[model samples]
Target: MTDRPNPLSDLNARSREVFRRVVEGYLQSGDPVGSRTLTRTMSEKLSAATIRNVMQDLEYLGLLGSPHVSAGRIPTQLGLRMFVDGLLEVAEIGDSDRETIDASLESTDHDVTNMLDHVGATLSRITRGASLVLAPKHETPIRHIEFVSLGADRALVVLVFADGHVENRVFTPPPGQTPSSMREAANFLNAIAEGRTLSDLRSDIAGELKRHRQEIDELARSLVESGLAVWENAGESSERLIVRGRANLLPESDEGAELERIRTLFDDLERKRDIAEFLDLAEQGEGVRIFIGSENKLFSLSGSSLVVSPYMNAERKIIGAVGVIGPTRLNYGRIVPIVDYTAQLVGRMISDRTKG
Candidate 1:
């Protein structure tokens, strides 16, 4: 496999310090940073000439940019990536923050969807930016399956997995099928589909139908097909994506002609498949992964930053990802830990629920 290239290389101590301060300042104020400003704000007592030389070295390294020659320097994409990877200092979650997170987790009921939604909204409020939560795609192995007919051609298919997870889908029976037919279909499924994943069961449903023709009437076969199709459609629909705090991105006039960029971003986010794929990438990494500016193709045009972490179940399977999105000027130092802590808390909740 080709290795990913490092964003920063060959910076000495002094140059790294200069680049770090400039990037931190730019992230704070969303402005080009002058050498004099760094000399004043940074704790180290570096001379303006020395800072300017370091800035020049950074610019040469493609880590810093000067929009106008006279203006101060700002961290380019390379600079932001470097700072995030190395110099960024994450603030620890304070007692109050922990209390708030615990309260949110404890107050919720057993509904995973509700818990994930609350997590997304809380993250958005905490970061003062938009948050995204991509929930699990329901990949657990099947323990048992049940069908409950609601009459009038509608029936509820209740799926129970080995992990004590239950999901339901409603399906319409093929014209004029009786509830007895539905019952026969349900019995046939429970007999043959136990301990199989939904995917496996779906592939073998037709074969089961053919083999059972001696016992099951045509009505039962029709109902079985309907039930299996409903399950397949519901499995396909399990990809859930929740986005909160989009309004937070709109008020920043300084985001430049990126207004349309934000629109495109929202559209892309609306496509759950893309968001799920993006979250899957983040899930492969440890801790929080910060995607700044053009580092990721999905939000590259928007000049956005994504701070993401995976939430996992007790079995250590990643169940989902939760994160914040904002302009590249986001407070990485603060939001990094926030995202990390939130992911951990979410993972804990999922694990606890699964164990219970």
Candidate 2:
């Protein structure tokens, strides 16, 4: 990885200390920090001239910026990244946090989707920011596919996988199909489709129908087309994104023009697809991954930060990701370990479920 530009690198020990103090103070208060504030709050004994010189150096390095000509300096994105990388100290999750997380994860017996929703809500409540949980995709091997008539030319296609997972999709039968034809189609599928993937079965059926004559009639063919069409459509089923704590964004007094930005973020989260895709990129790795402002293309426009970690299965395959999204002033020192610990908890829970 390329090394990041560190403003403090070129400074002496005292100068570096002053620079860090100013940045940390600014991060904590979300305000421009002056030398007087640092002198009062910090033990470092630096002359105001020396502090000003150090701040100027930091500003030149792109770590500190002044919103107004006379205002004190604030940590820019580069400064935040450097401070987060080297200076920030993360506090461990206390016993209360552990208890709360354990209670939330342990007491829930719902399906994966509901569990993710619960996790998102719990995380948002804990962090006071928007929380996100991406559900595991359907990747288990197919065990069987069954089509049941739901009356009025609609059929419910139920898919059973080797992991004992089942999902249902509804399909409308083609123009001239009757209930009898649907049953015949289901029977045909069950007979030849067992132990095969839905995609593979569809391909084989289509090829067979094109190349050779089979016992299946025109009506049965139409039913098969309907079933296959449903399966094809299912392939495009979007990934699930669960978000909570959006209302918290409404109360930020400092974020003026950012209110509209937050509104856009809420709308984007409602779509879920974009966040899912963003998490998919991060889920390819292990442990917690922090994406600061402009680091991830998806949220770069929002000028937000994401702290995400992948939850894995017993076999060590990534199942999903859980994270929090908020402004760059996000308490990374606190949220990083929180997200990491939650991801580990989620992975263990999923592994236990898979075993039992």
Candidate 3:
């Protein structure tokens, strides 16, 4: 992790104002800002020449850069990080946004997948940026487990959950396995699986088997291990990653290189596995995590930014992450709090469901 800079301390009042204006203007218009424009917009009586000198000093300090020789300057990724970490004035989430989020999530009827979809769609709509949601593991209790023999080498493990969700996993039978061993494996799972989640069962399996090691043979133990391994390997089924509003990332204008960048960002978004893995960085952090431009590997090629936060369950354990992806000039002051509030909202809803 790179150390974040505090450019404010390095700059005096006049230079700080000029730098802030440049960054804020770029964020607002997605274009470099000229000193003449700053002179016109600023309340201070500074001339364009003075502001130009200030911008030159900022540019020398690696905080601002001109896209072209004659063009105005914009904040570098490092400058954006400094502004977000030190200077950005984050706005509180409005009541209307809260109402919108509450309404959208409540209508999902406690379905985990639906809730995540609604969350992604709602955040995308609200922020006008692409949204990503990594859903928590489903905690639905197992209703029954059945192992049907598939010839001599493979078996089909059917798991029926209390939520009426049925999942089928192909299990490879152990050497010298018999039909009787399959029945015993299924019976053992059924005996302990009722009203327990797959995560719970997975953890308890080792303890349960160790306690009753004398009762079960090696073949059935291998069958159980293989069956659970198959399920564990199915990452998508157990923990879904949802992305929405990718079209929002496309700008109405700007062809050529900018268009190419958006295309690259679209390609990056297509790899849900990579994005989901990237979100693990958020889960490790305390609150909202911001990745600007090259700070994150997935968005580096696209020159994009990410604002992410992790959501937790009733016990305050982080189980998933949610975030928005946008161009580097994203309104960090606004989007940061929105992401934070959205994560908290999701945690509350999940906690409520757990209590119920």
Candidate 4:
């Protein structure tokens, strides 16, 4: 394997400290850090000129960039990577934060999809960044199935999975359908749905009808087909992407350029397919993954950072991912741990549900 050069090794203590301070300042204020600012923040008595020369050297290495010719420096994407990989000191999640997550997730413990939505909202509220949650494709066996009449033309199908997850889907009933036919249809589905997944049941429906054609009538058969058709369409939706707290991404001051970038990000968030593809990067590995600006294609145009981690199932299989998106100057030290903890909590809740 080829060895990647350690840029931290090239820097002496003073240079590293200056670079760290500049990046931290930029992350905190979302603005450039001048030499005068670094001079005061430094522990040792270094002149602003000394700090300026260090900043210039750091920029020469492509780790820092000056937004304006005369302005102070901000961490380039490479510089942010360097700091995150080498110098970042992640703070521990405080008890209050832990309580917040626990309380939010527990409130919707009975409903798995609702639990995920709450997780996204909670992360967004805490981090002040838009949260994206990708719900894993559910393949659990059907435990119970029921049909409820909504009106003359519509019915609701409630599916209970073996893992204790419940899904409610509404479908249109065929013409001339009645209460007895719906009940008969429910019975027919219950008879065949045992120990089979939604997709499995959908596939087996045609064969089941062929075998039991005489046992069921046309009305019941139509209702069954319509009901399963709804599930078939639902099954095609393997993964559900939930995005919340987009308003958090808007800058408080709302500069014209920044608002344009935020608008671009909002547009990016609306493109669920692109966001899902981008999130696939997180599921490829373990633990928290950081994608700085332009590192992932979805956020490239927005110039944002994503701190993502994959949540697992009972068997420790990667099921889905959760993360936040904000400007490149994200508070990595704090946000990293928050994302990590949230992922773990989600996994635990899923595991408990599976066990139950």
Candidate number of the best lDDT: 4
Candidate 1 lDDT tens digits, 134-223: 877686778777777798878898989888878887898766677787788878878876668887886697576457534423322333
Candidate 4 local lDDT, 1-356, one digit each (tens) = 11455587799999999999999999999999999987788989999988999988999999999999999999998899888888999989878888898888878856788898899999999999999898876889999888888999999989899988788878988777887888898898899888999778867985764565343233223334434211123223242212233344344533333444433543543575566678568789779988888888788889999999999998889999899989989988889889999999999888898678
In model 4, what is the error at residue 235, expressed in angstroms?
31
Which has the better lDDT: candidate 1, or candidate 3?
3
Off by over 4 Å in 1: 1-9, 42-47, 140-276
**Residue 158, model 1: Cα distance from true site in angstroms:** 10
List lDDT for all candidates, in order.
0.74, 0.72, 0.79, 0.80
CA shift of 265, model 3, Å: 23
Better of 2 and 3 by lDDT: 3
198: Cα error in model 2, Å? 9.4
Q: Select the stronger candidate by TM-score from 1 and 4.
A: 4
TM-score of each: 0.63, 0.65, 0.65, 0.65
Q: How displaced is residue 352 in candidate 1, in Å?
A: 1.9
Candidate 2, 1-356: lDDT as tens digits: 12766555667776667767777776578788987777675566767777788788878888788999988998887777888777777888767777888889877884666677778988999988899787676766677777777887788988888778898878886667777777788788778766677667767886875454233122223333434211122223332222233355345433322344434543654455565567567777787877888877677789789888999998899978899998888878888888988999988887787677
CA lDDT of 2 in candidate 4? Answer: 14
lDDT of 3 by residue, 249-306 (tens): 3455332233344335435435754656686677785688889988787888999999
